[model samples]
Target: MHLELHIKSGSRSGEVIRLNEVGSQLEPSSWVKENEVIELLLRAPAKFQSATLNLYDHRVAATYVDFDENHTNFVWKPQRQKNRSLECLFINYFGLAELSVELEDEEESKVIKNFAPLEVFASKLNAQNVEDMLSYLATLGDEQLHSLFQTTKHGAGFKEGSTSPNGSLERLEHTIDKLSFLFQSLFSKPITKLLPEHRVLQASGEEDLDDSALGWLLDNLSVVEEVDDIDRAHFEFNDRMYKAHSVQVPVLKESSNLYENQVVHGFIVTLLNEADKQLTNYNRTGSLKSAFSEEMPEGYSSFFTQVNRFKKELLGNQIERCVRAIDRLKFLKHSLDKAIPVTNYILDRPILTQKAEAQQSYRGVFIEYINWFERSCPDWSVYQNLLAIKSIPTLFESYTYYRIGESLNNILNPTKKGQKPIGSLMHDIDGNEISLIREPTYWMPKNSRSNESLYINSEGKVLKSGKVKPRSSQHKYSHRCPDVVIEVRKENRPSKLIVLDAKYTYPTLAFSKYLPECTMKYVHGIHNRSNNKNLVCSMTIVHPMGDADESLQSFHSLDYSIEGSMPVSPSLQALGLQLGLSQDSDRLGETLKLLLKQAGVAIPENLQLPLFIS
Candidate 1:
């Protein structure tokens, strides 16, 4: 009795295994029950999942399949994440088979015995049709792919905690992660949708079509070193090591000259494609290892072989976009006019004026940059790096000095409206740091509250705090005397407010475990021990490189949890950004801009000193 069996793997494919040549009575063993999940690592196994193999249970839907000897077939059905349902699909045995997934409802049970895919692929991968086989393997399902074998740690630098990607690793890791997902998807789906009863004949699996003509489809990497091992022939084309090879200096002088002439055409299109392939290959197989076009894993060959199909298409699309037409900048200019025409920076404040330095806030800095941006680059392209930084959310205040006008590398470029908010710090009109702010804070809270006091030389030490609720109906939260506070002293411009917080989460700074009370205690206890001045100028409670992760959100709960530390951005900075709103590429772009728009604030511009002739 040929029982129709449904297979259960996380995938949508099937595998044909000899369950047992022993059952001459030919009945499937009850021990091999239905809906049983047999995980073969991340792949499917060699058995079916159903009891009545010929009579369908109608529950299994397939995602992928394994075709054996061009005749026997095993198809996989991916598990549905939402419903927890599974699919049973037919496996395509031959070339360029589209993974067609089908759900087996009770109504389709009558045709259970006819579920077969190899017959269709058989027609495609026949002796006379060897050429199509390579293309078919090129279209290999995604699930069948895996990286060349790097431990999880090898890719660590690309993760959030480590230093950001700079050199080749950045591009490589991106491609690996991208291709991993892409390949995994292919492996997890149905490979062919052959009608039941199709007798797919078996053909010799290895065909002569594995020739060089089909191998060139992967992204065109500038061959640093290449050879065809098939003939044991040594032919060096573009020979150079990648790490030793710098984008700054092309390894091959000829290639460099060619690139120089076609830079605009190269960088965006071929360069990106080649870069994509180079990275993916390096990520999968180490840079010193074999090329990605070599072959899939061992068991992957049984089901489908084509792998880099989508990658090839992706390269083609990029090339078409790059050499086709450079979008007109004038057309982009007209688009910006819809917003309010701010005369000064979007955020206006004195750049480094004494009064400006006196204020410890981000709203002021955002205004300063907005003012600077408009005046400095009235013709600034919409795609500038400073603008890109705004997409990140919480940015380091220090980045402001270092980042400006860097060329846009597409890998790091933020999408059109998705940059991070700007970083915040108190700067003197001269752009010198008067003090550092731990978080982005709104200088003005709705109901507009601030803490002002005249200290009468109190013996008590702790920095006092004020918590004034907002009176304005539009404002919701009350303003608290800055998260931390300091008393005005005689040497310091007293009658002044030193409303700021110290940035602590930074390892360089004291951690949060030493926050509030202990910090306040130190402030009240220490004075005149080191500095010549009798007074400490100002005070603040901030984390270095203030970020929302350090400030607003809890660092403890993140997947990459930082134990006992505050998030990168302070809550105050977030709240203030919420209040005075502004855009910095460091801050996620839209929110910052929205907040900035709401505050109607702008950064102070760099103005020429008033000429004074005595």
Candidate 2:
């Protein structure tokens, strides 16, 4: 029997692949049966040499497939003759081809063997024809395109501790401990003030000296000279003449409750105690029986019940302890204020300094604990609402930004082979630690302006100098802010500006097309201000997705041409190129390199391999 391989799907108009020679047909004389092993030589099409052949259950590498003459032979074992198919997947490049084969019975093959004419087939893989295939792949879920993109631990810091048992909870407990210690230290010292004291002067050896002592002395003073043995009385009268003495006495102030530290400490204590009680209640009765026991959504009831049970059983006691510790911190903060004297300058300055430092340190610890709680706890809403602590989105945004930057850093300046990129923690201007940065600074050329320069004042409008004429005394200034702005400077050459914005959505075709319009707006805004059209070289939107269209494209206006693109790969190649890293450029990478070359800086050689590849 002869089997004719039919293209069922995944085939382009000009795609081609070669199979091992079998006289251009599988004849019954050499038909392979079930449980038989056969070697099939296959050659990758010229344009798809990077493609890998995927059998029903195995992947065959095609790196050695010859484009010149002979094909690469693949050993295939057929366990069953039911259904079988072959697929070719090109990496980095796009296009896929599939072939289906069915074995025919001897009687069926003999009926049409003589008159049937065989048709030969071949095709080529190119950029234009593969758009639909790429688009289709883009629509697929991430799991379906697993071979196309790679995932690395290099940039996923949040996930590092995700596997540990109650890791976030443990961290929160530790931070609480630190905060408690700091508060305890602060309250151990109290403030004291000196107050004037009025006390009646008494004879040194008076044992029963009561209110009558002063009265007796005053009575004897009137008859001082009448009595002969009046010497002691005279002395008493003189001593009584001194009346009440004024002495400085050290006294503890009652203003401890009014202090900021005390207030914060009390707040922390109340919050911790409340949380502890709630957690304990949940632990005892289960979350379903606790305050949040209201009927849940249809399908989520069981899932949420299980989650609540885990939180109550696993994290309840630990959280209770953390709350107790926070309460102790309040006592500590209060006690420290009352114990330290306000007049003891030597101890006063240091105490104030320590208090300030401890307050800040405790704040940081609480913030970290809060972050952990928000992530791990099922009833975090209670704590957040009670404490009035708001969760910041900037933290996650900052993490995303840092991961992107770190990925680029690793690609351009890798510390070690196979090292994954890590996220960075940063502090904002208000000393409130945040990861997302509206203005990020780089150590490269100091001549680079910040993203804030793109905007006008506080409004997010592009600054225009002469346009609309200045309103009265108002002056127009550029505040052109992009998410990230990098300036590359070379000796005796003008700097080049590369702008990047981070979006949490997948960079689809629609998003890709919209990015250029946004870039044009910023470019026009800048041009209106400086009248310099050559400042910005490129602008891009970075997102997380796979199988997106070519991210880089050029756009032209009356004054200047700017390149715009969206990078969806997590491997960092797109980011590295945009940041001016020089390497073998292809499409998007080429556009970035060309822009950087124009600025007169050459990127050094570095290994830019994908984190995961099939």
Candidate 3:
């Protein structure tokens, strides 16, 4: 395929430059600047019926025209992507091939590309990102990044004891508790039922003349040998000869030793044996290890730390607890060894499954055993480590979470920190604890707040007539959800709220369409139902583009005009901050401090600050 680049803007406007193929890399006449649109024209092989262009596995639309019997021409306007090096895959009926091209914004590209670890969550994991992530994972070693990775996996911290991805292992704890209760119940009062046993005796003794015996004798009178001496007339009884008549009698026997007990006991014994095997195997093989080598991979120290800590803290703890529970269960079963008889078959019948409680408890034990058998093996440890990954997200969103935490940590003393769902507690210079809440859903309160409280979202109501009211902005018809929210709690006053959002693209492109819709909603759309008052003080859009300072001017000029009934000003304010890879890291902290100051929150400047503040 012959490819040509048509520059639509800049000094090279109206210029068409042929992209020279140098091995795998395609060289353009001049470097492509960020946000610089270029019309890519491709001449396909005559034999090829169609062609497609894909960026990082996502298909880009191309305008195609059949140029004649010789070849087909296609034009595609490729936009600026997040990464620096654009690997365009030209897919056709024949096969798949890749073309790599470089851009002018190499530094920004490098920054954005470093987020390769975030690619794991892409709808489709293609070759490009995988290669990038693997290459980057080879040089990771930053302790700070490592710490961030550890916190990001779970909002409540790694040791918070939340349910893990291993379904059966989590259920094992509950199952063990249930089994303990079951064993206790059995030991206290076992299942006892009345049974029947039969006896046959000679009819000589008077003691055997009871009603039951006589009735039995009369019922089988033909067996009497009163005159049956010819056939088998005589029988020895107590050293005396007697008639051959015999009485059959029934006796009621009560015992706890039944088939159900035996079956359950055998099942427990089997679990004990399996547990022993699992423990022995686990002991022989140590805890799950990291996939990467001891030398930290380049650009992926944080990712490595995350995966390692996850395995050690979460998976390791789970395995340890599971083994302990199994041991406890075995001990309990051992105590009942003499009480319940050893059976030839383990769970021969479905007696445990017949009862509701027993069935649930039995399921837990069986599930634990099955999960261990399939996943807890020494060889399966690698698979478990792979499954431990849970952060899965777009790089910007993930980066924004950590970025906010990092930025705040510089200016504020961290009292508490958490991730996954994302929340944190930090004290600013004033010693007041501020909360950073991310993606929290709240039910709207009936009355407007008189004291400090987070803004409540309207979680639709169900009417008395069985109809439902859709959730909206308090009393309004729409609701707005922000990416990150900072709340400053006050002593005897209402808390202040500041909203921050992470946008991967430039503000110019975003505000042109749905971006304004989102920003405007956050400013004027959010309100309290009781008073219809706006809850937000200020909202900032954090973007990755370096030129955001200029592009956001137009967005900042735009505002929503509230009507007469509204309590606040007619115009609401929305600001934009340039943030992300290659962007100034301190910008976010400074912007937040300014927002707080404007909201009348005080901060002490006497404390020693980081040297990078200038």
Candidate 4:
């Protein structure tokens, strides 16, 4: 099989880049800026009359124009996709063939390809991102992106791959938008519960009371103090006077009324308030009202009108009545007669578990918010088997994670091996243990003791408990899930952290500014819950740029005073560990060794291999 990749747009438009035979390693003949259009022309061997071409790792079949009996052409545009190279595959009666092209930033002038071996494609996340980004983002159109963005940010687990133009933030905004709509729908007709309340009332007359009230009157009324004169019978009891010859008296009766003070009601109330606050913050930058309508529509007042409406409903329902009743009853050391105890919803069980439309809507809203709060990304169920544009950052993260683990395995003995996606726990000769966790979500709930990290295995499932995992000090409102985290536990010392966040961009001003802020979050945001101390000792930003600034690669301290922005890329020469394109493992290991030493971790003598050993 033979292939021809040509530049269809930009400064290099109309240039034909040659392709080598299958199995040959070659650099990208040329580069194109992100989102630039390109053309792929494929020709099958003489024996084969037709051929097939697939782009985005063959997840999306490329539509081609037949040039001849054996030749075909297809146009592809890498929309809003940047950094790292993308792989293209083709097949025919001659068998399968493969080729890759690197996509560069629009501003980058250099043409050096920071290529890693194709074996890097073995990682599932790398493959999944490519398939998901391409198929779901564009071919399915904007509505799909909007849907995916909503699905990911709401209740569904976060969809892997930062495919959207704005990445996770854009997805989150989409979720908020949907939630804003949902809250409005809910508040206009809030859910209510029929609460049975007992009230003590004095019977006025036989005709003035209902059947239940009459029954209570007949059952409770009796002579209070043995009235001597039945004609003049008037008794004083509980500081209230009652006239007799069978006169009016106080009685307790139970009546059911639709009340909005149950657990589910309070939950929705809290969600509405919090959603309004978030919408306000989101509105400061982007307008929810504008997104919703050009002008205020009927029944829609403002971005947060729903919250206010619900609050207004509370006035009519008088939730305060329940509160005052409870307070009085509790103060009097009496059993609750009219007040319903407000309690939190049980998280393990489904909220409003019933088969009604309104119940389902309430439950849906509750689950969506909880999923968002938990930071669980959407699963691949929405657009599985779809084509994905290869995400350079995700690819680099996978490369760096595996490369580091590969190097560590050389120095340390494998103590424990994880299943599914296959994580590892290694121990040095000195008994110091280091564990590699990939995309582990450290749930930093307000309760520190319950704060734990769940590992997302290769199959995208959370590893069951009892497997080794990372933990962090409690966080307020949000969870932290870094791409790659290395936990180092040395003898007689607090466990230290080495966080690797892979970025696939050059050392530009924006990149520099982002690195520190991200590093600080990883450094200080995640902490040791047991000791209440910071856990991260070194936070490295792994990029793929060969011409990175020196300052980017060098370690520096930020607010927490730990090393931050230590850029590790296969392109840069760290520790003079140069071995051509394959130097990634050595370069990463040397940097990790430096961090371990700084954190007072003792690397066993034999395990600390020399730089020349590769």
Candidate 5:
């Protein structure tokens, strides 16, 4: 863990923060060192925030001049000739930390390839205090701590407490980008849930009573679960924006006529008052309407009052009046009775007075806005708020894009069409966990192992067509049969199958090797008994071994293989690779990317080891 001790009160720039002392105190599983030059990743609390940083490596080596005395009893000399430009470094005593938690048998010196760069969070600003940063880091779980280390550059020396090495800098950039994106998004999402912003906007001109811009805006407020009553939505006619809302919109029913019906009347009312807004955004932005034709409709009388009764029936739904509880929605809705809340949406769009349209795509944009808002500004995590921000945001929008053109669904509109292919979840599977997920397509013919009877979907039984019933599968073979014949799509390429039946093995080679029998069992089942041709299969003994790596080595192929999670030496990459995972291009690269992102770690290049260690 690393921390920042705030020094140089006003600005961090140009402030001299020298290493005061260097030392350490070690515990069973951890240690704290002094005079260490560590780099920290930080966000300044306020504008114009800055700090002076000091660095050290050893427990008691404070002054570089002290290092000078230790080296040759010579005074430490500044490298730069100019007095002002002088920056002296104790070259002989330079140091960097290389902490390793590794295998017991391997010499710590022999483990050269470091995996992740981790940093110690030393300190930061909060409640007017310059406190210990590592103390907070201490509270974090090992995963988060591991992630912190990932943020650092492994095998690289530090200048200050939390800085990464040059080698891993690029990777660090990518990790921070992912984290920053998540943080910004999570922040925005929770913020919107905190407020009940108004939504209905007064239009300048008349459009449709149903699908018009005014109607949609008014309708939005009605179907929303917020805006409990008309009072919350509508102010006096004297107000600048004449807003009206729908009645109680049920939780899932946005298209209800009764409550939403009032929105239609509200549209006419807003249009009548704001005649300038009556024109569609198309007409408003473009020169289309003939000025002379639209002038007062040549002695037309105001029909607004006469339509009030009919509007009331539509709003009430005289056919079958239904109302939902307001208090219920308030508890869950965070607002009133609208299915989709819109106070922020209303404030966001200035289009009622501008040239924006009430297009479905535009409305969808608003829905997405709400989604983004709710995700970014989570109440629980202030560090990762995302409220309405255009900054790096995170959402499952990539899936939406993926669904646009593929075999899934033509869900996207014209504007949504894009070239970026949707990415799939790399099912880097492990353990008996695979069997836990019920197979999707293939039938899991759950039948007694004692008998070959098979059934599907609890009813439609699949029987091997014969004059008589087949004998129990267990009768011929002592082995218990799997009730399910799971199906999964093979990689769309020429492929082979290797089956390894993992088991306990105290000795080997006495029974003429489990290899041939284990290999032939599945082949015989596929060929002789089934009488089916063109089935290609290969096999290996999946017998369990004391050494997990040894078990993996026993069954190696370009095709897929499964192994139970072992007690020790479970190599993630080896398991993935040996199991025929598409690691060369897609899986390995993506795994690295995901790990880098999740770890907040980077891989820098061209950085040399620190001095003094040799």
Candidate 6:
């Protein structure tokens, strides 16, 4: 397989360079200038091992790199330098299959003559799909949900079937058992007893009576030689022999309504039926569709088969339990009446109440599970559509924010003594103290000229006459909400501010020209009059590209000078930190370390490796 590189700078400036073989020298079809940012586009036969650009065997670096729509074309910017030649530029494809490269003096010829099997890449992508689903589910704040889908151990490498923990069969069995226990615990032990009722029925000798008062009489009469009893007198009442007894007849009675029990039984039956359906669907040979509408990615047939067997065994047990429970509940409901002694009812009420509470809690969890299954899992068609429309850049931004926050916590609060980590801990920029406030809201006066004059309180709401305003106009005013804000306060120094904004766009030369304008907006918005006492030390725009010289130049060229006031000095910078689909923890840590250092934050020597090790 061969790859082609297309280079484009400004309009009318473009060249095509083809790599027929590794170590093959290629000259640009057009004149290339030194220090000029050139857009290099290459379509790889396979996915690259890393999304970042690697040049001259890692000697030179490229910026703003990413894969195009099909994930075959790689896009990035390589800025030519005075002494560096673009002759040895090569991208390493460490995908499932390996590529052979031969390096010679000044020229290395490496050709990807053989392609890795497509299934290899497909399976890996499939696993990643599962990982993403697990991550989203974890955010729902349900431990049971997490346990069900979380395959990989935290900080440990991803291993197949890690989510199952106990083998799938055992896990499914445990879940069914839990459901059964929940259902059984909902009601107290059967307390039905025969009691006297106004209505009575004649008992014949042939009739078998068990717990009824009539049955008791017949049993006693059979043992007696004569029908002489203190309270009962027997006589023939019909053509056939019949026993007429004056004894009190017993009827089954209940203390509460059976409506709730009936509803619960119905829910259990539905769940069991659904489980069986899923089991059956998965049990079929070559059926890789999961309960979720998305088809299982290729190479997971065996895994699904195992899961199906587990579900099948589990469903069998659950079905039996469910059927038996339903029968018992029906019998109790039919035999009992809603009139019983309050004292007897109270005697069993505590235990039954506890059981009912437990049942309610479990029912709630199952309901939530059902809701999540219905709403969270997309059908195959919808899933494919979503894949086509999903924004990779947006997802990358979210992950970057989390990664940056985590890295900061490890570096600044290594001991974990603080109430909250640095990333999420919002502090009052003007306040001298170092306490962290979550979702800290600032109230700006309506009369204020700029959106900078803001107020912060413990409740984050405007106070009026010792009470919060029911409707405050302060909400209409705009306030700065930077992507990441870090406030550091030293003993005798003013509070320092570090504001960062995460941009998902590629930082091309044209885009870099706007960096100064963007940085100025961030600075003025965050460091307005409300934060006059604090020093706006640094402002940065973080992206998933290489550092553009234009961005740096633009940031440095920003003017904070005023006519009559001393010029304000602040460090403005842009960082290209790639946090892509493939998790590169080392790269993340390196980027964060550089970001913090550039922002004037000191990294403790002992905290270096610990930040990314886990």
The candidate scoring highest on lDDT is 3
What is candidate 1's CA lDDT for residue 24? 43
Instruction: Please report the TM-score between candidate 4 and the true structure.
Output: 0.32
- In terms of lDDT, model 2 sits at 0.34
lDDT of 5 at 170: 25
How does each model score on lDDT? 0.25, 0.34, 0.46, 0.41, 0.23, 0.38
- Per candidate, the number of residue pairs that clash is 147, 29, 11, 13, 92, 11
Give stretches of model 1 more than 4 Å off.
1-265, 269-433, 439-520, 525-529, 532-614
Q: Could you give candidate 3's per-residue lDDT for residues 508-561 as a string of tens digits?
A: 544564356555556554554445555567666655444325423323333331
Q: After the best TM-score superposition of candidate 1, give how far the Cα of residue 57 lies from its true spot, in angstroms.
A: 57
Q: What are the runs in model 5 whose C-alpha is more than 4 Å off?
A: 1-258, 261-334, 337-496, 502-517, 528-534, 543-545, 552-614
Candidate 6 structure quality by residue, lDDT tens digits, 387-442? 22122233343444555555555555565523331334422223333322212233
TM-score to native of every candidate shown: 0.17, 0.31, 0.39, 0.32, 0.19, 0.38
Model 4 Cα lDDT, one tens digit per residue, 411-522 = 4533322211222566655677877666666544444534344211111122222254444234242456666677778777777777777654444522455467555456
Show where candidate 6 strays beyond 4 Å.
1-194, 197-396, 413-423, 426-478, 489-493, 509-511, 528-531, 546-569, 581-604, 610-614
Off by over 4 Å in 3: 1-75, 79-254, 257-316, 323-480, 487-496, 503-535, 540-614
The positional error of residue 592 in candidate 1, measured at the CA in angstroms, is 21
| lDDT of candidate 2 over 1-614, digit per residue (tens) | 22222222332322322333333553222111111122333332233323333432124433333445533222232223224543222111111122222212223221111211221111221222122222332232222222111121112222322322223344445655666665554455432234443343343332333455545545545332322333323233432423222222233434433233333444345445544654454344323222222432222122223334334444456556656655655565455445532322121111223344355543543444344434532322212221121111121233234334443334333443223323233222222221222343221111233332332222233322224433221222233345554455444454455556554333452254446554554433333132343555555565433343344433333123333243221111122122112222324334334443333334344454443333
Ranking of candidates on lDDT, top first: 3, 4, 6, 2, 1, 5
